[model samples]
Target: MSIIIIGAGEVGYNVARKLSQERKDIIVIDKDEEKVERVAETLDVQAIHGSGSSISVLKEAGIERAEILIAATNSDEVNMVSCLVAGVQAIVPVKIARIRDPEYASNEKILGKEKLDIDLVINTDQEMVNSLLRILDIPGARDVVDFAEGRIRIASFMVEPGNPVAGKSLAELRKDYSNLELVVVAIYRDHRVIIPRGKDRLKERDLVYVLGESAAISQFLASFRDRKGVAPPTKVMIFGGGNVSLLLAKALEERGVATKVIEPDIERCQYLAQQLDKAIVLKGDFTSHDLLEEEHVREMDAFIALTEDEDRNILLALLAKTMGARRVIASINRVSFAPLAYQTGVDVVVSPPLLAVNRILQYIRKGKILNVAILPEEQAEVIETVAMETSDIIERPLKDLKLPSGILIGAILREGQVIIPRGESVILPGDKVTLVASSAAIPQLEKFLMVKLEYW
Candidate 1:
């Protein structure tokens, strides 16, 4: 399928890069000549320098016969306008636009079919907010993704020395914790991906990926935690007064958690003070030891750095951890800096680009894919799709399902219940099946999940 992508920013560039790697027919449009040149040099795809919303630009990018158009320019207006123009000028089946402004994203009438005709809208800030909330909910989890309307959650955690499950094999883990139902989907060891087996042992510092029922996943994590009976956090401090911090403050306040926000700009701090009821807005640079000490940052349960500056966020987060904060979270947007942030030994690093890209690619994926979550480093994917009644694989038992080599059925959600699939388990028509598969197995999965029209 042919696809046209507007802009060469992180989100758009990443989407194009992945699609191009898959050998899809991709054409990228951007007004910046340098960006287009960079993409053209980096990936084997066509790049045009022009306004994405211009009808002439669309025609130049072959929008008429394109299967998808992604308006992902940094500017919300440009992205939305491009989608609108694509809707009017082309027969693109899928029009996905990246919109960051809450004003435009929160309103349905503005993006409805009668208005922008956008098939999907991706809001990076909102997606980051959701990620922050989930990470806060599951302390010690570096990343979390939900499926089947949150009945199942896949989480990533780093194994630490002296943890009970650190050196255990998959078989031993099952035998020891049979009461807790969870699956170890993938293991990231020394930056390498390993699909676990019954004999493979988990080592300290290994980034472990687990999937299961929300509550069960929490229960299973107890074995590897070194909390010493300490709870997560009731009081949290966040640095910056940006949109992400605003949304997080609102959520934390609603939960009655004592929250504090530190922003360098007094005007921004004042704005936050007026917007948040329960959270305190402090004016100071968190990088200063005197300011952090004066504000009693050491006493806070958790400290989060949410500023747009990646380097500043890392510095402040490291300072917080050094000052005895129980947990520290930092936001890092650049993919190149992600590993460096992790190496800094911060409690958690949230990448907004990865979060946004995963959400956007779900639209382009084949099948009745309910949700698509790609793991860090593109090692594997945790996919959840609704099983169709007429699909050939639905009525068979789990053990007999002809899955690809790297694929594994992690869980099944039927109605409101969570099922840890056993060999005898059978998937019914309405069940949401969650699977964990390597990158090589995705095409096979897409074909399997997509119901052929000729089947009837």
Candidate 2:
């Protein structure tokens, strides 16, 4: 596919890098020659220097033959205009733009994606809030990747000493729960990945990668704790009153979760206070240890550092964890510190650029399978696909089914429980499944599972 991305920022660069790896003809355009050159040098793709919305620039970037046009510059106006110009022709299968403003988000008419000539509208801040909430929904989980029509999920969680799976073996767990179809793919023992062999045993403090329905992930976690009804809805403490924090606080409040926010700037704090009634807004510097203690950081269920400074965010999150917070999430826009944060026990680390790229890919390809991810320094990917409707496996019991190698169902939310399909499991209608597979295998995987049925 000929994919042209306008803008050489983090989102654009990430999209270009991913598409290029699939051996697609990729081209990137930007006004900054230095930024354009930098991306062009790092990724195996073409680049042009100019205003992305300009007709001359679009033409030079080969929009005529491009199958996908993505406008992801920092400015919403530029993205809208660029996509509009691309939409003039129906040849492009996907035309996506990044919409950053929350105010514009409320007015769908002014930026009603359909009216804007953009096939997909990506809102990074909102996506981050949604993603964070998903993590919070399932307490004690380190990472949650949904796949397989939303029925299946791969959740990574550390086994606590008092947890149910603390001393259980994979075979033993299965024997006990015969009705469940869960698989153990990889185990992180002492910061290492152990591709499971039947004889391996699960030990306490091990970070396990489990494959099951969304409910299974929760069920498995609950099994560990004493039948205490749902880890008391997390008492969330957020540091910073930026746009992202405001959205997060609103989202949390809607869910009836308690949220306390600390911001050093009086104006931002006042602005947040006026806009949000659900969360407790306080005018104080979160940097002060005295203030954090006074606010009961030690008693917080979760602490999120959303300040603009990456260094400060990491430091505060670490401190929160040290202070006995059960979970700590840091919003790190810089990609480089992701590994450091993870290693230091940061429960969840989110990056705006990474989130932006994933949102844009989802906007561009909604009906297709797209698993977006990044492995530290390496450029991440968005696997695009369409599930085949012709396969006999559709709606069939998973135990009686077989999936291609290198492909794992991340989630399958069918009616209710995100069934992490095990053997003997069945597929159902209207299930949103997320699959993780190599970029090369995505097309073949889609073809294999494509199901076709006869209808009256």
Candidate 3:
């Protein structure tokens, strides 16, 4: 498919790179010559140095034949204008824009079908806040992605040395905890992803993704924690008074959590103080040992660094972790810096670009797909798609379907019930089937989900 992306910033570049890897015909437009040059040098897609909001520029980039138009420039006005121009020029099948302003994003009249005709609006700050809230819901979870309206959750947990299930095979765990309804979909170990089977054993320090009902997943994660027990964080200390931090603080206050925000800028701090209801806004550098000490950082349940500076966020997160905070979460904008930050002892690292890309991909995928979540490092994807009557996957036992390698049917949501699939399990049409597949198996999985040609 022909895709045109407006912006060569981190979000746009990452999206272009992913689509280019899939061999899609991509054209990226950016006003900055340096950003255009970077895209041209690094990615295989076409890069044009021009304004995306200009009608001439859109036509020059082949907007007439483009199937998808993504306006991800930093400026909300530019993104909106780009989409408006694309709609007027060719009525692109899918128009996605990165709208940062909550006011623009929340107004349906402004971005409705009769307005900009945007198919999707990606608000990075809101996405970040939602991610933070999900992570905080589960104390020690490294990552959490909800599907089926929060009924089904895919949670990532690191196996500690003394964990009871560390060295047990999947089969053994099922036999041991037969009452618990959960499936171990994938395991990340030694920088490699393993699409685990019944015989695969989870080792210490291995990051495993488990999928099941919310309560069952919580029960499973409880075993991985210490005997002392880890409670939900009641107090949070946030560094930076940016949009994301503000949104998170507001959410925390609604949850009745004690929250404090420390920002170096006086004006931003004043603004935060006025906007927040119960959150304490302090004007002080987070890097100052004295300020952190005075605030009693060690007593905080969680410390979050949401500063614009990637380096500073990582450093402050590490410092907070060392100061005895129960958990430290850092907002890292650069995708490449996430792993390094995790390695440096940050409890959780939230990447805005990755979150935005995942949402966009979910919208782009074909079929009756409900939701799509790509696992960390792009190792695998957990997709929730509805079964079609004409599809070959229905009306047969899973074992007889011959699913591609590196793919596992994790769960099936039928009506209001959840089913953990086995060899004898059959998938009926209209059931919401969740599959975990390695990155290499996505194409085959998509093909397998397509309706039979004879049915057409």
Alpha-carbon local distance difference test for all models: 0.84, 0.71, 0.88
Q: How do the residues 1-456 of candidate 3 rate in per-residue lDDT, one tens digit apiece?
A: 899999999999999988788788999999999999999999999999999999999999999999999999999999999999899889689999999999999989989998998889999999999989999988889899888888888999888778888899999998887787789999999988898999999999998899988878877787668743466789999999999999999999999999999999999999999999999999888558788889999999899999998899999999988888889998887788877998888989899999999898876666667788888777788898888777776888988987889889999888878888899999987888888988888787767665531133
Predicted structure with the largest lDDT when compared to the true one = 3
Model 2 quality (TM-score): 0.82
Query: Which segments of candidate 3 are over 4 A away from where they belong?
Result: 227-229, 452-456
Report the C-alpha displacement of residue 104, candidate 2, in angstroms: 3.0
- Candidate 1: segments with Cα more than 4 A from true spot: 226-230, 451-456
Model 1 per-residue lDDT tens digits across residues 131-160: 888887777888888888887898888887
Total residue pair clashes for candidate 2? 40
Candidate number that wins on TM-score, 1 or 2: 1
TM-score of 1: 0.96
TM-score per candidate: 0.96, 0.82, 0.97
Over the full model, what C-alpha lDDT does candidate 1 score relative to the true structure?
0.84
